[model samples]
Every structure is written in C-alpha cells, then in structure tokens.
Target: MAGKRSGSPDPKRHLWVLGLIAPMSALLPSQLVLYTKLEVFWWIGPIIVLIVIPVLDWVVGEDGTNPRDEDYELLSKDRYYRWCTYMFLPVQLSGLIIAAYMWSGDALSVVDKLGLAATLGFVSGIGINAAHELGHRVEHLERWLSKIALAQSAYGHFFVEHNKGHHARVATPEDPASARMGESLWEFLPRSVIGGFRSAIHIERERLKRKGHRWFSVHNHILQAWAMTAVLFGALLAIYGLRILPYLVLQAVIGAALLETVNYVEHYGLLRRRRPNGGWARCSPRDSWNSDRLVTNIFLFHLQRHSDHHANPGRRYQTLRTSEEAPQLPAGYATMIVLALFPPLWRIIMDPRLLEHYAGDVSQANIQPRKRERILAAYEYRAAA
Candidate 1:
C-alpha cells in the first residue's frame, strides 16, 4: 500500500459535495431561465461543464493529496460519499422529465430546445462517470444503480463490458476503447461504441452459458440493462409523444460521444507489454493517465486518480489514491476533452507527451494500424537519433 498524506483533516472533505454540480447543473439552467426569463440559460449545462469547470480547474489547480491509509475504511464506509453519487440519479432523471415537458409544450424555440438537449447531454454524460464508480462495486444495489444511471444514455451495456472486458484488455491492441497513437477521437468513437457493445454481448452470452441460463434469459445482465433503457424511453415517449424524439436522440448521441471522448483520453497511446508466458502483463498504475486537478477530481469523483482506480478496481471512489508513477495529463479531463475534439490540436499536444513518456520510443506506445507506418516514419528516426 502507498503511504498516506499527513493532513489532519482531508482538504477535500467538503469539496466532495461539489460532485453534485454536474447533475444539479442540469436543473440550474431551467431555474435560471425561470428567474431571468433568458433563453440563454438553457445552454448553461455545456457552459458549466465545458467552460466554467475548465477555468475553475486552472484556478483551483491540482490536488495531489491522498487519504491516510487508516482513513480509507472510514471514508469508504461513509454514507455521505455514497449519497453524493446516489443523488445524481434523481436529479438527472428529473432534468430529463423537465426537459421533456418543455419540449412537448412548444415553450422552447428550436434553438432553445437544442440547448436544453445539449445541457441534458452533459448531465447524461457525467452520469456515466457516476455509473462507472458504482459499477465497480461488489454490492448488488450499487451495480444495479450503475445500470439505471446508464439508462439515460442508452449505454447500459457499458456496465458489463467496462468491468469485464475493457478492464481485462485495457492498454492492449485488442481493446477498442483504448485509443492508439495516430487515431483521432473521431475515428475512435464509433469503433469503441460498436466494439464495446459487441464485446459485452459475447461476454454475457458466455457467462449465461456457463450458468445454464439462455443468453436471452432475463438474468443476462446486458439484456437486463438494455431493457431498462427501453422501458425508460418508452415511458417518456408515452407521456411526451414523438415530438421529443429528435431531442432524445440528440442528447443520447452527445452523451455517448462525451463518454467515449473521456475513454480516448484515459489511455491514449499507452500499451501493456507481453510477458514471457505470452500473456499480456498485469495492469499497473502507469497504464492509465492521472490528473490531480481539484475541480475535475471532485466532479469526476476522483476519476482523475484513474491509475489508482485501475490498479484497485474494487476500491470506492472516495478512497482512490493518486500514484506518482502514472503518466499525468497536462490538465484535467474537461480541458483535455476540448483538445480531443480537434484531431490536429489533440495530436500536437499529446503525441509528443506520449513519446516522452516512453523515453522517445515510438514502438512502446500503441499505434493505429492504418497510420502505423506513417507515424513510425515520422517519429522512429527522431527516436533512434
């Protein structure tokens, strides 16, 4: 176990409350619009996530502090930290209902509805982060909550694949979710979405077969999860009618895109080496990127301490630690997410940093197959020199 920091009280003790900001952010724009009668507030969700949080991350700066080893049990057992994530579901669902009502009533202009959908998209995307935290736990309720949270984005299969598949093959060439060098986020997004779903189905099918259950049985976790999405969307459509269909689809796409963007950043160009036995080496802290930026750390529930989370998958979010061995992102996920949308800009900022991480060895990093030759031609000479 890593040594704990020497602080008397956890500095982020109260700031953990800010974790609620993303889900609450969805409600805020509506309340603000009510108060100010400005249609612009409908766009506040993206503004808060993409703009305000990045600025706050820069201003608040990094928080590399870790909890005392003894404090882990106390913090993890705390109901307060659990509620911080649990509360997100209600607020998230409420925001969708509120948005649906608005969309159905024709109260919002087309542009205003688009803004509302974008805002909800952020809430749904951030909800995936919350689901990621809960899905890793052993408790059945937490696992089910994870699936329910994903219902909004229609990405419940993530619960199955992420825990069983992505974690198993992360940073390896076979993992679609792990971005490679020379592959743009635009190129990686659809690949991950489709690949992850197919992988989840295969995993669930085998699991059910081993347990003597049919793959189509309700006990199949992947089917159970997708069923939740179907029910949620069905109820919403029954009440809201087809007018909100476009908004729902738009928000779902944006939400999925946001989740995949973070996936691209988390393990971009990092690779796990093969062992003497021909099996891939066990995952270590360095396989995942780490960031200690305070604002994002709170919003993401210590997800920026990803190296620790990946190393200890069973650890609760409140107790996840940071490791100096992990490669660090130059900024928080929010900042990196913006950079990821532009392929050239993302490569310019991250490619050199990745090479530097591997001590100038381009082969040590994962490279996209189609661009492998071109990438090596460009960097291998400099690496050799």
Candidate 2:
C-alpha cells in the first residue's frame, strides 16, 4: 500500500469506496449467469450501477470537506490513487470483450442484451472520466494511458479537444460543449456530438499546423485513437462475427452520450461574461454545476466537483474541493442524467436554478438562440411582475 498523506482520512474511514470498482469487472460473471441453464441474477449490472448506487448516494449523502491544503501536494502525488485508474483499463477491456462474447452467443434476452450494453456503456463511460483526470496530468505515460482508455468510447479526440478546445472556450457561445439555456438534451445531443468532433479536429489541425506538421501526419491524436479503435473493433468482428458490430457501435454511442450528458449538465445556462477586450472572463468555480454528493464523487474520481475542475484543470480528481459559492446540481450525475432525458422536467427543475443563479435575469443566461425569445419572454415577464 502507498503511504497515506499526512492528515488524510483514515483508510478505515473510506474503505467501502474501493468496493465500488467491482461492477466493471463483474459484468462478465453476471452475464455468465445468463449462459448457464440454472439461471441466477443476470440483471445485476444495471441494477447495481443505476438503481442501487443512487439509493446508496442518497443514504450516504454528501461530503463537502476538502483535503487540508497542505496535504494536497502529497495526496495528489500518491501513486496509489493513480494505480486505481490504471487498473480500470483492463477492467473496461475485459468487460467489453465479455459483452461482445455474450452478444454473439444469443442466450440473453433482447432487454438483457440492451441492459448489458447500457451497463457496459455506463461503466466504460467512467473510463473516459478516468481518462479525463489522467489526461490532464503533466506525465507523458498518464496522458497516453488517457488516450488508450478513451478508445473504448471511440471518442479519442476528447483528450485533444477537451484540453485544448473546450477548456479555452467553455461557457461561451463558441463552445459546443456548453449547453445553452432552454436547449433540450435531444437537441443538444446531435449538436454536441457533431460539433464536438469537428471542434476536436479543428483544434488538432491548428495545433499540428503550428508545429509544421501536416494534418494527415502519423502524429495526429485523433487518427491514433481512431486507428486503435478500428483495429480493436476489427478484431472483435473477426472473432465474434457481425453481431458484435451493433453491440460495438451501440456501446460506443452510449459511452459518448454519457460524456456529452456530463458536458450538458456541467455548464448548462452558465456564462462567462466577456471582457471589454473581447476575451471571456477567466473560467471560474461559479461557471459550472457542482455537487458534493459523496458516492458519485467517489465513483467518478470527484468529477462532480466540476467547479474546481474547470478552474484548476491541472488538479487531480481526488483533490477536487467543493465551494458553496458554486452553483449546485439538484442531485448526483446519475439522477440528473435520468432527469435530463425528459425535456419538460429538466427545464422545470433546472431553468429556475439557472434563473436564480443569474438573479432572474434571463439575458445573463446562455439561452439557446433559437429559444431565446420565448425563454426570455417567459422569465423576463415573470421577473417584471
């Protein structure tokens, strides 16, 4: 075991969190039950991850405290924290391979197969989250492992765009990752999916061009990730046959959607005011939706404390601290993601929060231009009355 940071929480205090890692590795065993004639708990993956985890989050509640400022350097530098994420790479890989194997065998029901895909997708989605934390490091190996993890989502460009493109332009109209006020998730999905990929490519090409390298050069990060994904999926197809294609593509879509949903939530309706010089305000803790929900933070490497992530992009996840000044999410990411699927409820719940954050001034909110008039009319009219 790596030495604990001075004044760190007792190992006994948070040992339970270590158990949260099981689902990614457990998918095979759960699905294996479906393959057996004597049926057992085959639907465990989604149930544990989606249903049970939320209940646990509600029960365990939030932890708002930060590591002692003096301890941050030692804590963040702890190799033990990094190893937990490194171990997940194989866990994600094995889960997908077993999922493809199960999907090829035709033993599980359609619902279970979809359940299986969604389950793996969500788990693998966390791999991207892991990659996000690892990608931000100054370490070369960690950054490369970050890209390797992202290949599971087929969103390899994220390591490039999120760091170079999204961070620089976040909470502005020009940033595709920031969801405008009054934009539905359904609407934001296609726009984000397409625009995000294009943004990544644009950022990468500009970077390479600056370095005097052609866009088509072997050094392209997007090509590197895509090439690995192609070889991976090609191998899966050859081994598992055509059935794995739908499974592969569906899981990838679900994984990417998981990420976009986070992007949608993190800064929905938030704006960084433009300076007189035409530059946007420096990204701040106030610009993102933050949650101190303990369980989700433990599972996602403290990504729920996103306010700090945007403000301090180089900070490791374990040290992400909460601030009362930052806007709060209504719930953890899983519950919020479920809520975001319904446009009506999502607006009813989130719009008021956005309005409150801006003190009822809709003009300050990042309203989707298409819905700008209606949204402003509704809120502005209410504020006047």
Task: Give the clashing residue pairs of candidate 2, or none.
Answer: none
lDDT of 1 by residue, 1-385 (tens): 2224423246677778888878887778767988999888899878988899999999999988888787777777878888889988998999899888888886679999999999999899999999999999888998999999999999988998999999999999999899999999999998999999999999988999999999879898988888998998999999999999899989988898999999999999999878999998989998999899999999999988988888889888888888978999999999999999999999999999899888998888888988887888897543333
Give lDDT for model 1.
Answer: 0.89
Q: What is the lDDT of residue 169 in candidate 1?
A: 96
How high is each candidate's TM-score?
0.95, 0.91
Candidate 1 deviant stretches above 4 angstroms = 1-9, 381-385
lDDT of 2 by residue, 1-385 (tens): 2345433542323542463474364455564564775333445555665677678889988888776677678777777788877877888888888888888986777776776777777766777898898889999899889988888788899988899989998999988999999999999989888888899999899989989999888989889888878888888899999977876887788788888998998899999988999889999998999987777777787889999999999887777788877999888887788788899999999998998998878788888987777887886553223
- Which residue pairs of candidate 1 clash? none
Q: Per-prediction count of colliding residue pairs? A: 0, 0
Cα lDDT for residue 111, candidate 2: 70
Report residue 284 deviation for candidate 1 (angstroms).
0.7
**Which numbered prediction scores highest in lDDT against the true structure?**
1
Best by TM-score: 1
